[model samples]
Target: MLVIEHIPAAIADEILVGKERDTVVMTAEERRWGRRRLRSSAGRAVALALATGTTLAPGAIIAVEPTWYLQVEAAAEPVLAVRPRRCGWFRSGRCRARSSCASWRH
Candidate 1:
């Protein structure tokens, strides 16, 4: 098991030119976590004990070994799209509910 306590600053592409790459896929919600155990696509166990307020971003390199480095990848999540029945309501600058007009204030 690999315990990662600190995340390094972004590494330039040239710096990792010859290194093999492995990835750990995490969900959007999981990316916000500062501490958790995860598995790389190569099946390596990785534990993150990052500081508070530390959030993992896509492509973030979490570990660098002799021959390869582990990076983070965000998993695709389902999104809900809501469309109003009447598009004219917004085109005319008028909301269906007057009580909610404050929400549309710009």
Candidate 2:
């Protein structure tokens, strides 16, 4: 069934008996950090598309593929200043520091 937030589950079940979920459950605190209000340009675009009854099938598939690209860039920044070694060599290998030597001191 199509799950929606803020809408009563009973009503949603009736409307989306065999549809899909639209929202996921998150803790109140996690919601603040993990979820954000859909206010960005992309958010507005999606909202507009939905309101206008435009199809997002192909576009949604395309968007989903690149969703992790942003996360990959954010995750890779810290390593840019350091060196990468074999997976198990971190604790045993010598690494050059970017600024402070504290990381290699011990």
Best by TM-score: 1
| Residue 15 displacement in candidate 1 (angstroms) | 1.9
**Superposed model 1: Cα runs more than 4 Å off:** 83-106
Note the Cα lDDT for every prediction shown: 0.83, 0.25
**For model 1, how does the per-residue alpha-carbon lDDT over 20-55 read when each residue is reduced to its tens digit?**
899999988899898999888989899999998888
- What lDDT does model 2 reach? 0.25
Per lDDT, the best of the predicted structures is 1
Predicted structure 1, TM vs. truth: 0.74
**Residue 100, candidate 1: how far off, in angstroms?**
23
